[model samples]
Target: MKNQQDHIHIFSGEIADYWIEDGILFSQSKPIKRTVPLIQENIELVKKITQNQAMPLLIYLCKSPVPDKETRQFSREQLSQVYKAMAMVSAPGLSQLIMKMVFQFQKPPIPIKSFSREESALQWLQQFK
Candidate 1:
């Protein structure tokens, strides 16, 4: 098994930093802030990582507030193509609620869920592996 940080790909944006381990993509992001070119860059990196094989993904949103319309739209448009499943780690708060609502409305192509702990997120993602 790879160490948690072995495949981390640190990004230059406030949106998130990503990594790949055991065919799963792990992304850690802060609260919704500037999310323009950084998100695009992150998407490109994800594409590169999963170029040959699709992988499940887990996103850890630390203190992430609800995302704005533009950022939500970007995710709705781009995420499903690269990942088979996505799990998000966030506490029960506005961010989690908003994410659930968005998922309900946008209906991403792959399966998605939110958990309050990293272990739970990883466990959920494992089914997709």
Candidate 2:
């Protein structure tokens, strides 16, 4: 993991800590109330990372409950512009359900999938490479 962090791009927020490793953007968020501005900031950080020619795969590790409607909507909108593929790792619960529901309602421009393990998520993302 240390090797992967060599070119890490960190985005720290009250709710989450985001970083990029080996072209995969990873996010781990706490169970804090999320607001629009905070969500937008997260998106902006992703935008900066994706500005490079090579688009990266996203691996979001959801440790918190599902975000509100607006945050989910905004994230979908912003992510569509940048990601080549998205892989989410979350337990089987509301968080996972919400993620699946969001993708079902508004299909992302890129491929997205959910996994229970980080290794599986990373392996799946390799197809986009």
Candidate 3:
């Protein structure tokens, strides 16, 4: 059987690709404004990639929240919709129940495995890779 690391590959270009390195999930840029359209675009992208046998994952490496927010949690109105999207993708084991539980919490105290250096993220992602 191929190790997770052996399955890792990069396809950098106009269309983004998904892959895991260590334990971190990585993906290309999703559009701004966390809107339905933008989210749908990402979902389509995930579907297209997964159809090709690539696992879908997201790794956010940002010094601050994209909107400069104090926390990573989405706003109150965004929670339900986000949950729905996650549920829609759970069929093929794309989204795990633990992830769902983490997101489902009113205030998930779970610390996002973040790192100050790309190397650190890379090292962590290696576990899953």
Candidate 4:
């Protein structure tokens, strides 16, 4: 069972719980230190969810431990493999701070944005659909 919103529960991945609605992929990230193997598992789940089609992703924010270099590299290289664009919905400033750090290290291969409200994030993700 899940919170009502007509959400389709897809899977409870190693890193997140996934669902899809409105042509967008949604994830509630787990507070876990993402690893290369875990991210790989997530990629497989995502491909299966979208039937090998990349689509916009909306991630609910969680405080995850910083990943290791190998894990980070793998995650960055594989993002475009499953997501065309990404929208992170979080409380004010949290996503912004994290994104700033990510940009400083390396620009994401796909368009990404952060919003404080799920409605706004979903509205923005609609453009990519």
lDDT of 3: 0.38
Weakest 10 consecutive residues of candidate 4 by summed lDDT? 1-10
Worst lDDT run of 10 residues, candidate 1, spans: 1-10
Q: How does candidate 4 score on lDDT?
A: 0.84
lDDT of 2 by residue, 1-129 (tens): 223355665777666676776667666766776667887766666666556433546455555555678877777776656677777777756446756756658667678787777788888888776
Candidate that scores best on TM-score: 4
lDDT values of the candidates? 0.70, 0.66, 0.38, 0.84
TM-score of each: 0.74, 0.72, 0.39, 0.90
Misplaced by over 4 Å in model 4 are 5-7
Please tell me which predicted candidate would have the highest lDDT against the true structure: 4
Q: Please tell me which model should have the higher lDDT, number 2 or number 3.
A: 2
Rank by TM-score, highest first.
Answer: 4, 1, 2, 3
* Model 3 poorest 10 in a row by lDDT: 82-91
Local accuracy of candidate 4 as per-residue lDDT tens digits, 7-124: 4566788888888877888899889998888988889998998899999999998888988778777887998999999999887888887676556688899999998788888888
Residue 8, candidate 1: Cα error in Å is 5.8
Candidate 2 runs further than 4 Å off: 1-9, 52-54, 63-66
The 10 consecutive residues of candidate 2 with the worst lDDT sum are 1-10
Evaluated against the true structure, the overall lDDT of model 2 is 0.66
> Can you write out model 1's per-residue Cα lDDT over 17-91, one digit (the tens) per residue?
667777788777756664546667767777776674668988776665555678777777776667888887776
Per-residue lDDT over 54-84 for candidate 3, one digit per residue giving the tens place of the 0 to 100 score: 3313443212113313222433333333221
